[model samples]
Target: MVKFRNAAAAFKALNGLICVYKPACVPIQQIQHTILTNLCRDLNVLPDRPHEKRVEIVGPTNAPMTVKLVPNYADNPLVCGPRYIKEDFRCSWATHLGLFTSGVLLLGINQGTKLTYLINTARLTRAYKIHGQLGKATDTYFWNGKTVEKSTYGHVTREKIDKVVAHMQAAHQKTMFEMSGVHMESQTMFDLAAQGLIRPANNNLPVIYGIKCVYFNSPNITLEIQAINEYDKYLWTIIHDLGVQLKTSAHCTGVQCIRQGKFDLDIALLRKHWQLEYIIDNMDQCRRLMEEHSLILQPKSAILSV
Candidate 1:
């Protein structure tokens, strides 16, 4: 673990990506504010934060004989205000997780803010473990939304669900090539697919590289999906579509992003660890992760290997 002599040193060291596990029902902006507020509070309490220096006039009315520079306790952070505020830090997220979605969220601080753009443009794949409930359909395709319809899920078997998932995956795979902006008949398409998952040239288009049903019980089902440029609604709609394919109704119970590119939930900071020390350590770990996977920083090919 890297140590800092002072708060300033620690603050300065916060110049890379940090992963946090965002809880459900909380807005991303609130999470950002909380993290920044914690950082400011923790940093201000650290040692070596000197009071502001002020020049004290020796002679008052007539003439100033000697002017002595003294530490101004009145202007000290404790007296006036905190030296740092949430606004002092430049923090940005690489991806926008929905208000209802939760899990690994990557944030870039200060100099690392530039890297967020790179990550976005790189079109890195994100893995999600989505939970769905059978016999329910909502207006928004999620559990929180208004229930629009419901149906019997007794006929929905594991084999039926797996078949639907396989069909969905195959359909998305075919669409991936079309959206990739490559000639279907050309050899380039084969070469790219042969290498690995071909990233869509258009970053705005959501592409699902892989999708499979990981867990399945009568009324509950879980899917493991790897996709890029996806939105929360898109993922939720997948559950809705799955229900339709199976001749039943379903709504997404939860959406958890397990991984994004090289960053995974294992290294993500929980709410309790969103302090200065943990943030600095997380930044260091992120730097190491990037070093180990240089392709994350600079992609040599559009193939999504990572």
Candidate 2:
């Protein structure tokens, strides 16, 4: 479940940014919608016009346009008429995860929304723990896809899997050929289920940092992968090319932003500073709080400049 902390005052004073832990089976857009809806409801945000019952006639209109207002404090709007309040406050993750995948999703809220471009290009590295089965190939080049090839793994051993991981981790920039349809380009990686035939002419290097087979017990294998790219398909393609027959589709079990930098997401550190009351309606106080919690990156400042 996506959790939302009240950062309205802090956001207005300092900058708005949020760290969301998106679980599997939930869309990123859905998480965004939930946050927006919850924040709106909590802040008592009303329609644009709360006081006016109707809009005055304009040049094209012959009669006044009646406005429908649902009073937040009204118990029976139809019987008691409309009621209005004067409280005014307003507040508003781009690293997309698949519906079946779960991981850390960074979001920029309110003024923080302006930092999307900078954060997206900040070269943040991500770590993922993926689980999948071995000994079969799916038609879609991933275990989640329909089964296309099946083979006996009686001869496959843990040693073989380790070698494959080492091969992938030690692979040089020149040896790694990008597979088409696995995210980019159009060359096929495994047309006839042969690894030798997968020679995609793409000359670009893979953005993968390293891959390690964490555990290999029979049909299930856990892989700890570190990559700079956004697409998880590339990891699947690399695993396939390394000769691991994927029986089950891979699911990211754990994700962490490891690199210590401006864009690295360390939510635990940020949560402590989410004290909205401390920075409530005070820009100077917010700046002081920000300085005190210097771990909160200054990307929000860069966003404000834009």
Candidate 3:
């Protein structure tokens, strides 16, 4: 789901700094200034001329980490800023400031993954005018909504930096990864606006959207792969239904070892999505993932996918 992409944990930490410190106006410029000047600096070194250089919050794969900029105010499109700093801002910064910072990170993206899937699935259900044109997963809702207090947070993570004082980590097993083939009813949106129908700005068209890395701490790539595979098949089924001629395939790589093991997964993914190239890269996150496994020496990246 789009919710859990927390491309980079920048927005989460930004929320923490805003709320805890209780800044003046809660204005965008003011918030940005506060985040850049105060919170970011205290956690890790701030980049010089941050506004000058393109600050992109990314994952291990260099993909834009989608973090929700939780509003101190304003709720138009329910917009959230993506890619403000490098990915895992929580892992990096939360190590210093503690749980509240971590919560900020989770609430934005990782935690939102489940809800995103739920809401989208619900939307597709009502919008399911075209039968057999979408994946079955889109029809199924995982939110048995029976709320238990235990279901409140995303996975707990640790900020294990190896440094004695920097050993805090967020156990991220709480987030859920999902694959959805919801036929987004955005044709009306596409029909409007300036640009012609070359590409839909809303991307409300039928898409086989898959959410990987929702639970970044999950050790098993096989499970995530299974989710992706299902999404891919769903896409294929839809393509077949529409009688569109398009070849399909799959590719992935990452540190393929354990934190206590020797090999690391160093891989990437790029595939033909109805002739359009779509990629989910955690090259950097993959690097960090490999780093942990590399504590055993012979880092995986050194061997492959560097």
Go through the candidates in order and give the C-alpha RMSD of each one to the true structure. Answer: 3.1, 12.8, 26.1
Local accuracy by lDDT, each model: 0.87, 0.48, 0.22
| Candidate 2 local lDDT, 1-306, one digit each (tens) | 212253343224435555545666777667666655454443433232233343333343566655554444444445554332212222225355567666566565556555444455543446776776666766655656777766666666788778767766766322443323342233342332233222223222335556888887866667777655446565556546655432232322233333322333334223223333322322243334446656346432111000
lDDT of 3 by residue, 21-119 (tens): 211123223322433433333333322212222334445656657544332422222243322333433311110111111111111123323423332
| C-alpha TM-scores of all predictions | 0.90, 0.56, 0.16
Model 1 gets an lDDT of 0.87
Per-residue lDDT of model 1, residues 113-174, tens digit only? 98887886676789999999999999999888999998999999989998989999999988
Ranking of predictions according to lDDT: 1, 2, 3
Clashing pairs for predicted structure model 1, backbone only: none
Return the TM-score for candidate 3, rounded to 2 decimals.
Answer: 0.16
**What's the residue-level lDDT of 161 in candidate 1?**
90
* Candidate No. with top lDDT: 1
